[model samples]
Target chain A: MRNLSSRLSRWLISGPPLLYLLIFFAAPTLIMVFAAFRIPGDYGGLLPLLQTDDAGKTEVLINAGNWHDFITFENFGRFFEDSIYAELFLKSFWYAGITTLICIVLAYPLAWLIARSNKKTRDLLVLLVILPFWSNFLIRVYAWMIILGPQSYFSVALNHLLALVGIEPVSLLFSQFAVIIGLVYVHLPFMVLPLYANLEKHDMALLDAAQDLGANAWQRFWRITWPLSLPGVWAGTALVFIPALGMFAIPDLLGGTNSIMIGNLIKQQFLDSRDWPFGSVLSIMLTLSVLLMAAIAGWAGRSKKERA
Target chain B: MALLEIRDVVKTFGDFTAVNHVSLSVEAGEFFTLLGPSGCGKTTLLRMLAGFEQPNAGQILLDGKDMSQVPPEKRPVHTVFQSYALFPHMTVAQNIAFPLQMAGVAKADIPARVDEVLEDVRLQQFAKRLPHELSGGQRQRVAIARALVNRPRLLLLDEPLSALDAKLREEMQLELINLQKEVGITFVYVTHDQGEALALSHRIAVMNKGEVAQLDAPETIYSYPKNRFVADFIGQCNLLDAKVAEVGGSRMKLEIPGVGLCEALPVEGAQVGQSGTLTLRPEKIRLAAAVTHDADEVHFKGKVHDCLYLGDVTIYIVELENGTLVETMLPNSAPGRARFFDDNDAVELAWRFDAGHFLLG
Candidate 1:
């Protein structure tokens, strides 16, 4: 009787989250995978799988006799047929890669400083890193818009400095640079949090040992700190890169027309062009690519462990 | 010239002084120890020697070179931390090779040297294993091997054996002695364990409140401590509160509170009718039910109050007539579980005339 109660409690605790994920996340993903193989409707969404004759009799139209009418592979074919889609995917990868690298470079020192600070100030610094979440994300992007605008003081100062060297005044707003800045700004906390957690658990004695064994400052960091903090780096990469790769809002606001990424194309396929099947195909490919990257990272980490 | 010398070094953290005007010199190829309790400035002294902490007003001359300007990286010294501090990500071999790689030793010689040190520590078969994969003793050996791989002029060990269990600690103590003899490097060790210091050091400096209370050979420090602190800190002792009644050369008569006048060795500049303490070891007392008389011995009478039965030795706490407790240790070598004395049994205690050392206020 006690075992039964314990088992019931276990299920009761886990049931809500399981049901929610199955209904919201897993069901939509399965439906999208099925949609990627279907034909586009005359107006929008997927084609109907049933039809009625003139005699008012209902019949199924998705069988082998008329399978081509409802079921199709052309949506998947179109993604491969057009090189433009492939180029857009490449552009998105490049943007996400740069954002992740820059985030690591910027967040590492901040995280280290927070980890090394005394207990009284450490909580305050971590709270400051997370304070951006309190305000609306869209509002933060708009704030960036003002900061990088053509008439803002920052851009004016940069242009003035460029004029002194006989260089052309450059536009900071609605450019690739603006897009990168927005992406990095939005995802920096994700990088900092995980890196801080990893750095905080590190033993300070290791650095002393390294130094006592004749390691200079740079060598100590490169040899000891960097290698030990790889797990955090990878975790931060996943948190930032996955979301940045599928981002459309930043590109829509700051990219103008020259920097439209794959995310922008996917949004346009479903909403503007009214092609849900093709959109599903692009979304599925993005998911697959992310899974492949995760697999490669896992394999690399495991192999290193085995070697050690 | 000494291999390592500190000329009046002082370290302070704001209002608190960690190491205060400490000066000492260590000879080359000697096993020296800084012994103290927690926060007694021994660690601070070791840090100064390792170049981790700079002295506010002093110079550290290592091998006749002023080490004030050199950083920890440039100093020819390495430390085995109490926690071992082995890099978790690196294998045993890689951990040992880190020093060689940082020193820019010839790339070709790095592997051989790492392997050699690993073999010396008897960890060759575990080279490919990570630090967490090994036991605590193995990890300690790895830390030692890593520090000794490049053979720095001096090796500093900051209470490296304090983390192990009692059995493992004794085993490692013997191993440390053997390893030091094999390496022949000048060692500067710091620990709060007085027994460990006594067992390993050729010379010991006992510190108290950021200053050295006594510095001498281990035998002298143990047998004739310069002050009450060193005598009390090193081993179990019976300190009798006494006053000097008369002084004659190195011998003096001390009138203890309950045991009457006793003979002991006087401190320098000993004056008659001054307050002092008579420190005597428990093992030095000749304890028995009734004893034969010696020519130059002080005899006393007491009743056994309590007894502790350890495997090799048993301690008998005897209460004198005036309510003073004195402990005397006897070996339990009679091949059975029988103890020497029972509680409330009257016993006799005696020691030689100059066996007790006296410290004056």
Candidate 2:
């Protein structure tokens, strides 16, 4: 009776979430992976794998004699056949990399300031960082769009200054610059929160020890503070890079013709072009790349721990 | 000439003065200690010596050079912080080699010096270990080695052993004494633990408030405290309120209100009819069931009020005929349970004529 009760209790603890993920998440992902290798029907979705004759006996439509009856690798081949898909992925990586760098550069000083503040002020600053999440993300992006548009006061003043400096006046909205600004603005809090958590735990006595041991201010920061904060840096990098790499909405709203990334193309293939098999193939590749990136980061972090 | 000197140093934060007009000099190769309770400005004064903070109204001279505008990094001094502040990211050897690297020592000479100091502290086998990998005592030794690797003229230690357990603290105290002797670097140590200060220091400056109450050798500070503050702070002492009835040379007669006349060694400027306290140590007084007292001893008739057995020694609280309680400690030299006195037992408490020192108000 005791053993049965213990087993029942364990099941009760893990039953709901396990069942929910299996039904909602795991099932859909497996279907998508299977669809990636199937042939597209005349309409949109995957072709039927089984067919029924007039006599009410079902027969498999899959045939090794016919290449494209039910299943094929044609969707994956189309992706590699067109160099446009590879270039789009490279562009997305570049945009995400730049956004991550800019977020770090802007977030570090803000995090340090917040971490060093007194208790009451530190709470208020951290609240301000998280307050952006309370509102609709689309509404925040739309607000940036208004600010970056040509007729807005900010863009007019910026272009006026550029004209005065002997440079040509330029449009700010619907450009790569606008897309980058939007990406960094949305992802900045991810970098600051982890960096702040790490910096807050540091002991000030270590800096005093460094200074007492004949290190200048710059040397103390470079040798002591910077090296100690690497774990936070890596965490912030992963948080910002993963989302920025997969983002589509910012580029859709703010990017020009040349700035469209792989996310935009994947959305077009699924909804506008009605190419479900091609879309599934693109999604699988995207998922694999994200997983590969996470694996590399985890490996790097573990190796660093072992050596350090 | 002294190796380091401070003249009228004062440090203030807003309206509160942390170190007020403190002045002292440390000799070369001397182990000097600043002993005080918390917030007595011992740490503040030590920070000034290390050039971490500048004095508000005085000059600090190190090696006869004025150090007013010098920053901490420029000063030829280092500190072993209380928390053992060894860099967590650096290994034991890297932590010790930090100062040498910062000082721009040649790359070839760095490894040899770091290894030597590691061997000196007997942590050669754990040179590749991180600070968190070591025990508390090992981390402490790493901190010391890191500070001493550069061989500065002065080393400041701020309660470096307070984080250890009692046994470990005692062991580290002895190690600290030996390290100081071997390095021959002038040490300016600060701690609030009086026993630690007494055991390690050549000279101790007992501080109260933001000022030095007394500066003397360990023996002198323990046996001949100059004031009620210094007397009470260093160890357990009984201060009996007394009035000087007769003053003569180095000896004076004091009238304890109900205990009648007793003689005590006088502080300077003792006069007749002056009121003061007689600071008497616990071990100086003798407690027994019966006593054949000498003429040079002041004797009292009392009842044993309570007793505490402390393995090595036991302290007895005796209530005199006048209702004043006095404590006396005796060695537990016997092999058995070492309980000498019990409650409500009639006893005699006696001390030599000069056992107590009188501090006038």
Candidate 3:
């Protein structure tokens, strides 16, 4: 009797949350996957045709002929057949890759400074890095919009300097550079936090030892510091890259018409084009690629551990 | 000329003085140890030698060249840190080759030199393994090998054996001595363990409060410590407060409170009727129930206050007539050997007249 009560208590603690996930998350994902394999309705809805059973009773059943259409890979076939989707996919990867690179370049020196600072200074710097999270992310992005706008103070001053140099006045917003700047600005802390945590635990005495053994500052950094902090580098890269790939708001707010990424294309398919099956197909592809990236990262981390 | 001359070096961090006006000269090919307790600034001196730290005043001369402006990499020095500080990502061979690589040894020549040093440390079989894969002793050898690989003029060891277990520390102590001799590099070692210092050093500078309290050969430092700090820090010692009764040639007679008139070596500036202290090592004093009279020895009567049976030796805490406590060590020789003196046993202890070194109070 006690065993039954204990089991009931365990279930009571976990069962509701698990059931909620099943209904809210798993159910929608399962439906979306099933819908990806079917043809869209005339009005872009996913209502399967109802049918009656041979038993003298009416039943709500999916049309079996739709399976034949799914087997033909109609949605996937159309997605691959379109070159614009392929171009958008590549463009998304390029933007995400460049953003991750820029974030790494900017975060490393800042993270090193934080790690090397005294305790009080370190706490204040880390707080400054995290202070932005207290403000609304969308509002922060909008703020960047004003700062980078063509007629804004920064751009106007930049244009004056260009005019002094006899160069053309450059438009700072609604460009690829603006999109990259937005992505880097948003994702920098994601990179810095992990790198700082890793570098903070680094044995500084190793640098001293290296120096005593005839290593210059640059050699010590390249040989001792950089290689040891690879795990954090990879972690920060994933944190920046995965989200940047599917980011919609930053590109929509700052990028030009030429900057339409896979995320924008997918949004257009589901809403404007009313192509539910194609949107589901793109979402599945994105999810698979992310899982693959995570798997590769895990393997790299494991290999590094084995080598160490 | 000495290989390294540290002339009146001082280091201060804010208001705290870490190494204060310390000066020493280390000869080439000597195993010199800076022996002290923790926070005694021995490691700071060693760090300054390695050029990791700069003295606020005074200068360090390596091979008669002033190293004030030279950075650690350019200086002809290397250090083995207490933590070993071997690169965790590098293999044992790679760790050993680090110094050579930093010195710009050619890639083709690196592996052979690494192998040679690895063999010197007797870690040839573990070359492919990472530092985390090795044992404590093995990692220590790797650190040592890494430091020695470049053939630096001086090798500074900052309490490298402090991390090892007792047995491993002893074994590494002997290995380090042999390695120092083989390399023939002037070594500046720092350690809190007095036994490690005595076992390894040709000469020891006993540091106290950021200054060298006494610097001498191990035997001289052990036998005739210049001050109470060195005597107490080096080993088990019994200090007895005494008043000088008379001063003769090379010796003085002291009136010890517990033992009455005792003859001691006259330290410089010891005058008659002035109060002083006598330092006697526990091992130097012999205890017996009855003893033959010797002119060269001084004897005192006491009772055994406590007897401790440590495996190799038995310690007897003897209470002298005037209530001064003196500890004496008697060798056990063999296991289960009976002790001569037990608790409350009346005994007479004698030591050589020169055994009691006089120190100013």
**Number of the top candidate by TM-score?**
1
Q: Looking at model 2 chain A, which ten-residue stretch has the lowest summed lDDT? A: A61-70
Give the C-alpha miss distance for residue A184 in model 2, angstroms: 0.7
lDDT values for all models: 0.91, 0.91, 0.89
* Better model by DockQ: candidate 1 vs candidate 2: 1
User: Which DockQ-derived CAPRI band holds candidate 3?
Assistant: high
**Cα RMSD for candidates in order:** 2.1, 2.2, 3.1
> Could you give the interface RMSD of each candidate, to one decimal?
0.6, 0.5, 0.6
Per-residue lDDT of candidate 2, residues B181-208 (tens digit): 9989999999999999999999999998
Give, for candidate 3 chain B, the lowest lDDT window spanning 10 residues: B333-342
| Per-residue lDDT of candidate 1, residues B1-361 (tens digit) | 9999989999998998999989999999999999999999999889988888999988899999999999999999999988999988889999999999998889999889988988889999999998999999999999999999999899999999988999999999999999999999888999999999999999999999999999999989988888899999999888888898888776778888767887776667878889977888898898999967686888899999999988799999999778888889899887875597899999999998777788887
What digit string (tens of lDDT, one per residue) describes model 1 on residues A112-195?
999999997999999999999999999999998899999999999999999999999999989999999999999999999999
Q: What fraction of the true Cα-Cα contacts (under 8 Å, chains A to B) does candidate 2 also have?
A: 0.97
Model 1: residues with Cα > 4 Å off, grouped in runs: A1-8, A52-58, A304-308, B249-252, B265-268
lDDT of 3 by residue, B236-314 (tens): 8898999999986867889986568988777777778898778999998999897665998998898999988887889
Q: Could you report the DockQ of all the candidates, in the order they appear?
A: 0.88, 0.87, 0.83
**TM-score (all chains, Cα) for each model:** 0.96, 0.95, 0.93
Relative to the unseen true structure, what is the Cα RMSD of model 1? 2.1
**Best-to-worst TM-score order:** 1, 2, 3
Instruction: Give the Å shift of residue B62 in candidate 1.
Output: 1.1
Task: Judge candidate 1 at residue B204 and give its lDDT.
Answer: 97
